[model samples]
Target: MDTGVEGRKASRVGVRVSAVSKTIKGNRVLDGVSASFPLARVSGIRGHNGSGKTMLLRAIAGLISIDEGSIEVFGEKLDARGDFPVGIGFMVEPLELWDEFTGLEMLTLLSSLRGRPRENHLRSALTRMGLDPDDLRRIKSFSLGMKQRLNLAQGLMDAPRLLLLDEPTNALDEDGQEAIRQVLIEERDRGTTIIVVSHDREELDRIADVQFIMGDGRIREV
Candidate 1:
């Protein structure tokens, strides 16, 4: 990974949550789960199946309809309607993508959705992720690894402040996984707050500054 980017801050920021909780179908999925993320550091959410790791991240990203408690990014509380998930970026478990759209087309549409994502930045980000522009021409027809690469490119397009990734290493080869690690490190260095839910302990150990273990919807620091 290249930690060679200039014009970046040396110190990382902080993310805090207060009295946070979430439930579904009368079942409390996340129980009073609250934690903080330090700036320019990688945090890991590790847990077994159905442990609410994804749910917690979803709530933080405003993808899930949060009903209880609150989330804060950079000391600001997020209301459902406004300033929520401040400077956040995320990719969930199910891997949402427009199958019929070419990789370039998909990214272009995403750029349009967020006002405007520099055309040059999009190509550069994809290159940094080890993807060729040619890959976009047939991305939907590519394998899972290709799709994952596209996803990574998409999430990093806007260079969001807080990034949430669920099982990002899955469907990737060793080289691809290493590439992602490098990118994550570089992004953290660029002051992007990151939270990843992964099953690989060794891999998480390499990236996480803070780690959490989840159980029965409750989370505790490891």
Candidate 2:
């Protein structure tokens, strides 16, 4: 299958947020947060609750508009209305899955929407996430770990160029967490840029090429 588009000329092929800030309901969330998540490496963001970590991820994912500063994915500048930066995938706090669709069916549908070739790519992603591609159970029937794996499979199946995962190991045991870590490392080796947000400092330290700590809406390299 053809991998998506390639060769976007930029100083880096990943996410760049500059002096970005946001406010929600008159409350400041991101206070001049600036960071560069480089291509082909895993960059981790560690922060406590309400520290603007998830908000930063949302801004980068084009899920919300920033009240100040700019965000660029690859080499392209982003605005409120533009299509989500191409070749990007994200798994955030609450996933909205079609409870009626079987795991493979969901993958097939998403691939169709994304214009990605199905077959090998979708199955490979499921396998990588330790999910059985042939599992015919509907998403509502899946256990917590199974649901998490399915969420991951959806994000990774198309081989996105920039992957943003928020608390990727939220519902998994040790083995499941290790599987995700390995997959992330593999993705990095294959030139897929990654930005992960987790409270697990040790996990970030173990896998991240660079690490940042977010606090009270501020971000700094650690």
Candidate of highest TM-score:
2
Estimate the Cα RMSD of every predicted model relative to the unseen true structure: 3.8, 5.2
Off by over 4 Å in 1: 1-13, 81-86
TM-score of each: 0.89, 0.91
Overall lDDT per candidate, in order of appearance: 0.77, 0.86
The sequence of per-residue lDDT tens digits that candidate 1 reaches over residues 1-222 is: 122444233434466766677778998888888787667678898998889888888887777766677787777777744343546767886766888887777788887877766877778768877877656465558789888888888888777888889888889999999899989988887878788998778878877777888888888888
Cα lDDT of model 2 overall? 0.86
lDDT of 2 by residue, 98-141 (tens): 99998888889988987876789889989999888888888999
